[model samples]
Target: MDSSSPDETAPAADQTDRLILEVARTELGLGANGGADGDLVVLDDATGALTRAALDALEGTQHRVVVQETSVQHALALAEEHRGALGEGRLLIAGLEDAPADLATLLAGRSVHLALARLPKALAALEVRASSLARAGVPALIAGGRVKHMTRSQNEVLAEVYDEVHATRGLGKSRALVARTARDDLRELPPRSSEVEIAVRGMRTAVTLSGIGSVFGGASADAGSLLLLDALDQAISAGEIEDTTRSDGADGESDGAPEEARAATPGEGSPAVLSARSVIDLGSGNGLLAAYLRSALPAARLLATDDDLDAVASTRATLESLAADAATSDGAVGTEESVGVDAGGRPGEARVLWEASLAGQAADSADLVLLNPPFHDGAAIDATLVQGLLDAVARVLRPGGQLWFVHNSHLRYRHELESRIGSVQQRARDRRFTVLQATRS
Candidate 1:
């Protein structure tokens, strides 16, 4: 987290943030005497600028403001910058998936009078926020988003939980959807479920995965992931990568994988078997890739990490569902303690962390890393976003480790991988996607 002062960054709040603040203060009387008598929750302030200004604006007021950010990086930055800003209030690092329960628990008897939020990209994310605010018994919510991103469906989603939903006039191409009167009948949005078939050790296996609305692709496997999976399957079939999950023609069990299938030993001028002992799913969005890895390499230690709290929680749920489905089909599966999965929460073997780009991981720890880096930084197309991930992967990969990377064809990440990690091989290429395998030298 940066050590810069929050006050210094408050001015950096963009047009959207400024308009949201103006609407809240002028239209809603947010900082006035008669308004916001109860609790106020601020959501999705990425830079902590909006949050910092809100805290200062509400100073000396009876209304206690709660600051919540889904991104751990943003949350930590805000916490570090504003140590004493929340005198009687609370700063929470949570997402729509966990924020409601967390906020409810923290504010035991308190009811939220108002919620100010920057709108999320996905309708499912919007639905989650609306449902969460409704559950908190919020009287009014002023949600702002860029005019280009706003849609009629968003209003419909909010209307499901709120009695009235209407958009305010556009200001500088940004607008706010003011929703009032929380509906009496509101239920939390359940995780969406979908079945996807992926090639596992040359076998077509169908797995059911679930993800909250906030998670990317919302439980459905994306095309890029499918391409990467196909590349992995091709490698295993060609004997370049050992297939530990191969069935023995009788039961689904491998009894015990051969010694060659259990280790990745690369000698001088000898072909290396990519039997990874430890694996990482970088930017594990909905845990789709992580869930696949768990079933494909049950003995390997897996770590699924994401920057968003929603992704972390969604990955947890997806893996838990995988464990449950596996247990029912092939007897019981014990929870592995090596990965730090709680014994009570579904049987899982992957340890999930909420961190941005392998921040705390030690050097030379992972044997294999699967990366499908997100190209977008909010609304902007930032190709440099993957640079940080490539750097982290270079540090964390061992001498004989491998990185399976997938990206858009136009991105041409081959040179990037060659320079960052080691020798890069184009395993698969289609019209839109390219899957590459890079070895750590």
Candidate 2:
């Protein structure tokens, strides 16, 4: 268990004294590793002289569980399988290299008393998850293995989320910090909204947001904004939103007609008819496309899925309202006049609402998959997340099923899609975005 030897180069006496003083005074749960004893678990893959000594000191403890970090996907699978068995007695230790999504899923159902790591990515995820759990009244603890000069705003945010935050004395060339949380009755507060102006086609469009997180600043900025811009341009190019003067005689033809009668008769020179057994809106922001799909494919099943719980709830409300309005329409409609489709192709029923992550979907589930997949993790562009999404698409989409995804024109997803699933062809392209329609062979 002792990976470092005592005969190794010892630090100067002054430095050693400083280290001892720092560990004793500043570090939480420091000193001898005997206080928590069997109650604490240590997980570390990166070996070092001090960390190895710490692990060696806890050897005889019955509660100590050490799991070395490995491949993220494999580690996540193991964590899920062993989570129930460990209960709250175990602490899942992960390095900074672990996947954020995997870590989020693991921490969702479990009581992670403390997570110790030096990875910046892991630290950010831990902060976000801890904040979310705190807002939910669930006490969660996240400890950082390194600390440096941080801005006042950063420290304030951390203090707001964690019950206790402590910065360790700078050790050698590095520093460490610990954040702890205890159960409390923290009231849930509504998320603040902001308006971000994005430049699209030489024009700035404003986007409203309830929370500024990965969905807005990361993936949505790269995928959603570009996709919306492209879709708008395509609508213009296809004449779906064109402005044209109609004759007075044509206007008279539908002046007094019922809504159903108007829908039944296709307008002159309508866009090309698009048909499918079902349409799924992946990452359906505000469920706008879902609403349109519900109207266009009255007979076709429509399913909307998103990772955001709030979006799902909002969509449910929107769909229900749409159904009520459709039911009250002035047309001479029977029981078959419902707008949304059922889960299994039963007509005139509400669309099935389900929550799922792109990395954890079943196979051959949808006829059409529509997505504006996230392309970045925070400010850093990540192609792996996009690849994971495409992999999920490959699993969920039936053979010959199509994937209609919108992304910025700069991102090169065509190669990743082709490599993972099959061929990818650009269905539509514009100055701001590109729409890809891929099919599984």
Candidate 3:
């Protein structure tokens, strides 16, 4: 984290980023003379463009700049790519319970004078970000976004955390929201909750889901995920998929075929039991899919991973809540041991991880992977992310492992899945969403 001279040809800020920088500079009284006495924090700049430009603009100034990004992938990129420009102890992975002592110390005591942020689309996300800065005693914030993406709700969300909130005039299709006078008694947004019915051991069971503002779709169950779950239930009941939990095997391949007898044990109407030993819920937003898997496949070891720290926390909360609900249900749906870590400190049946695209996942490791990938990157639609996600999931899946994927119907990801992963089968499709089951080659 040592500071060096910024790269001469770093990515420049776009219109929105530039406007944010401009507003921040004006609000902080950082004029051409470059004499300011406080630190700065930049939020959610995925490209590192805003951060780099800020560093260059603040060069030789009294103020220090630290960037806080929710995505581990983005944070690592900023640290590695902009190593020359970013100073040591200048980057913080926000929303972590155990942040580094030095970073916490640096940010403590209302030291951050201002924050420049790319306003998140979700009001909850914006509120969470704003409340943190306000709680830390940052006096002002300059948040910008494309004019088309900006909404009145953003102003309202910020107003709740600050004494004053106003919008800037549009600048080349970009605009900013300036909020000042951080409130002393700012309240943190509570995690939202919703319930969705998922097939658990051949029975329709309602599972509670929880998420903070940053989590995608909040606590509501995504339609695509629901479709995927239905497909999984059908596949398992038809003996198309089975729990091939091998106790001793290095390769992730199922040697045995259709277990005709096990399907009969569940009876005529009930869904077949899935004893999959290892399951990965990639991008486990709000833990909806992971919670479903936890109940549906109790014996399976569950691993949930997400890029956003908030989403990871949301997943943990959702699963933990599930375990708590189970404990008092009097032997209804799931057991107390289904979701969290055991008393011995070892992870129980389910584990939630904050990582970038299966960062340290081993090849051919998981028996089954569930994914409901987001097509949009922030406010803009981005189809490229799907291919990258598919590639990552392919590497971790063992030979003959299954990837149960769901996506918007318009995205038409079947060809991509067929080419990158192995054979692809359309498990379910409606007017809006498509569910595909791809087998690892």
Candidate 4:
């Protein structure tokens, strides 16, 4: 019901993708004749196109297949494909908004065929399916297309976790990797993943951040964040931003820090600005932005939120590591009141949700929000995800609050920026990216 990201550039594929899909589909009880009764197939990162063939092959009267995908658009499209089945409850299509939870609840004590796409993402999906369905004595049929999505080494990494892992006959350019999972193995296998270090600096000194549980193109020091960082640092140094520690009617110290952080009453023509006391990193992927924001505005409260649990975990780890480093390195640690750790051992509060929007955050009084809205919603390119993020900004940002945003240069979010919040201005731009600032009027 909310929005999502990107245009998945459809690769020129041979019979490989279709053949692999067919193998996975059939393996999941989508027989040449019809699917078995009470069979549900979970297609992680599924597009509409992939589920269509399986639906077509199913005998409407004899078989039932409940197909689930992660994207709303994909789910709607699949629903249309089997309108009759949907009407009869013989076939069901829905979005995996809550992901593994939704699928797990649906798959309880049921045989499942999980068609996974996209390499590392599939691993996360596999973890969910295997753990949830293992105890029911249900056989899982997992088929992966696009061998390039995962390397043989990556395949082997997962094989160690499952009872048995195997490969299907190579189909043109695509090959299927299937792993049989057991309840015991599923409960015991530790996650296999890698880590990366990211360094982001604006006008201020560089801050090195760490990221674990790779997701979202794998974490790195994003150039877009750096672009916004430049603007943010400029805002901080030049006294253009409101003081993070000041309060209404309370006099502020007027020396050393930027003039904006100084105590002052708004002039008649000047904007009635609010000091940023609460900040949320909407769509805080990898938590790098949150970490940088925490460093840049030490007085403000920071909250990093993401839809992916991995991203939240990664972000929390990065922030904790950064905080730990700061505490020991001849530095003043941020006030524990403003920078407390979360349940996951994340240094600052990190909340995970199923959507990009920051609804019900900050008690509806967030003073600042930063976002790099994802363009890819699942496997395909979509812009509505950005819109959803913007909506969150409008809903959570108090009047006179600000939104710092970065996007692909061609995304051309200026118009939407103006429409959503007044006084949109370009802060920075490069060949591939653009950074903008909008204040909620």
Candidate 5:
């Protein structure tokens, strides 16, 4: 074992460390290394009390000495280098926190007699690693400074893999557990899943998963779960998913018309107003607006951003399908040879789809933005997301850019938008929805 002077800069010693020391000294009856030389190693010098107590217990035993330094890289290298030197003597590796994977694997391969590790979080990865070592017939001991109420199934996994599993009384609000994996009775256990029911706006919804998937009324389901679902249904029923097209002679431009003339000419059946550039569709469930933008703004640049990765992927699929349809239509119309980009310098036909966190998107970068920002994460209404949306608008829009968004009248987002982006005006309003427009100063 390697011994070094304790560093004074370690975190202030707490009652928990003192308790660990008293328990090891009294329960294990360890003394200084004056006689009975044995193999002993001190692992983490940062926690001097545990190291001292462990060293006191193994003093004067007929064991060779090996020391593991605290640096993760160094400790791993040392373990690999001295694996052959361990012979038949027991190895004790103790620390306030568990070692990293490479070091743990190297130490386990050595003729390790005992392995002691402590960690802050009881990670699932650690549990899996411990199970593998226990299966290899290695005697491993894992202890923590605090106790945590692990799932009953996880506890069973530990009990099945280790010879002994012990948990101590709560230390303040934290708890700790110790597991010894030295016996042959260890058995692997089967994994299980559970279901949870959430009540959102008086509607019962069921979700199935291993852990509680109903927290905050299925916020994990994305956005304001039930509200977003209802909004999406409304958007679909409102014919928001229809594909709009413009006619060949709609614009008075002949085959070789100038770019400005093509811009001024209205496609035969297309909407008079071209879709705005630099668009953002928040709460864009399934990306209907993004798909609409692709066709509506065939000449204008388009950006369809959402917070849901699934929605983004779905929108991408829809846009790709639209592109294929456009390609087929081009042959019939005698339009340009290609479908996406034209010789007239029109914007690319493909839509740019992206995922963004409303609370975290960049500002002052868009010419036009659309939003159906959520009012809550779950059952509880969070006005903070409204502020986040306003902030995102301020960050992602250029000066004088327009922001068109839909929301319930009850939200009263006018004041919030006015405060962040300068003026807010209600362009349209109804019982179930209000369409508001704001412009950057």
Candidate 6:
């Protein structure tokens, strides 16, 4: 639902965003799409609100704006704010996760005034996305906060695709970059480096994770995930898993699938005779847990989901590399094949979804779910996302499912987890992180 009327931005518009608009307005002499039947496209995946705020600044003009988002929370917020423009076709939305392949097709030959807000994901992903925008033949793109947000690597990547990429002086902590793109060589991008691969182990199996700078804790597996993985393995091996699978959460299958069919039979099972029959990695960054799960429980079907574009792409890359590694190693052959890598780089046969929140996950589905809920929003330790994820976990988990959650030690999530999930217990804890296990009632 649109939050704002035809001519207004949402009431929650902050000062920093409005500041960005002022800079854009001053530098670009902002106006409606000037070309015949042209509409400006706001390519924002970083903050998600930049497009809305920019549109708000340009609201009274004759410009038509299209907002494409992979994050569901942001799309809904902007859509709600601009309900009138959406109904009249003056504004539109596209989901990057839903149709990543269609990005080029959507932007082809478009006379777009693109606003690339400071990317919240990795620079490698930013490069890929920027190249896509350049390939679409956008005439001009005004990047928000280029001075403060962009690193030298980021600037170089942007400069490679966009001609005359120049920056403005800082506007109180905010800055801008206006680029008149020279987009003929979009397919000619330089290769990304693979120098910073981090190695982590769950029990005896060691996996290499290569992540970009924007990923939490870089490419390395954090201590929390490692500890939780061990505890989960022990629980599954002991048959402590709850059996409340309603439906396949990743596919939105009806809540009527038989639980016995997906479970591991006691002594009757043959070559694939194991427990933890199904698993999901919530916010599976670099797919560390998924890889670990595949190594530990080879027969389990794995599904990895994330809201961040970089995390999704990086996780796919990580899993694919793991699959290739498994094929070469003496032991990982079955593990690799069982994980089921699709051609599009997803972990399973299901569509690699980019959900804004965990709201619509399959209810009562899964034997085990592993998560390390992120609490930091910028510099602040925000618990709102953690709360939301916990709620989603309760709704999606089956009667016998297990939730392995690792979070900051200081957070009061134990009570909340116990309330939503059935039984909560501390598995491990250190100064910075804590490992928790909660079984669904």
Tens-digit per-residue lDDT, 38-126, candidate 5: 33333333354444444435544455433433233333333333343333333333221232222334344344444333432334434
Could you say which candidate leads in lDDT? 1
Candidate 3: give the clashing pairs: 1-88
TM-scores for every predicted model? 0.82, 0.50, 0.78, 0.58, 0.37, 0.70
TM-score of 2: 0.50
Candidates in order have lDDT scores of 0.72, 0.45, 0.71, 0.56, 0.44, 0.58
Model 4 TM-score on a 0 to 1 scale:
0.58
- Sorted on TM-score, best first, the list reads 1, 3, 6, 4, 2, 5
CA lDDT, candidate 4, residue 427: 88
Give model 1's clash tally: 0
Residue-wise lDDT of candidate 2 within 1-441, one digit each (tens)?
Answer: 122233243322233233433453344353354533332222222322223333334444444333423233333433444453234433343421232222234344433223333323333333454465465333323333433334334445567666776655556644444455743645433333444444433345454333312223321233453455455445434533211112113222324643223212346666322224445777654444455445444444566765543344344444554565566442111121111223353332335332344443346655566787666776798867776667777887766566777877887788877776677777777776788877666
Specify the poorest-scoring 10-residue window by lDDT in model 4: 336-345
Structural RMSD, model 3: 6.6
Candidates 1 and 2 compared by TM-score, better number: 1
Reference-based TM-score, model 6: 0.70
Q: lDDT, candidate 6, residue 66? A: 62
Cα lDDT tens digits, model 3, 240-276, are 5554342224343433644223322343586434335
How much does each candidate deviate from the true structure in C-alpha RMSD? 5.5, 12.1, 6.6, 9.4, 14.7, 7.3
Q: How does residue 67 of candidate 3 score in lDDT?
A: 71
Which candidate has the highest TM-score of all? Answer: 1
Better of 3 and 4 by lDDT: 3
Which is better, 1 or 4, measured by lDDT?
A: 1
* Cand. 5 TM to true fold: 0.37
lDDT of 6: 0.58
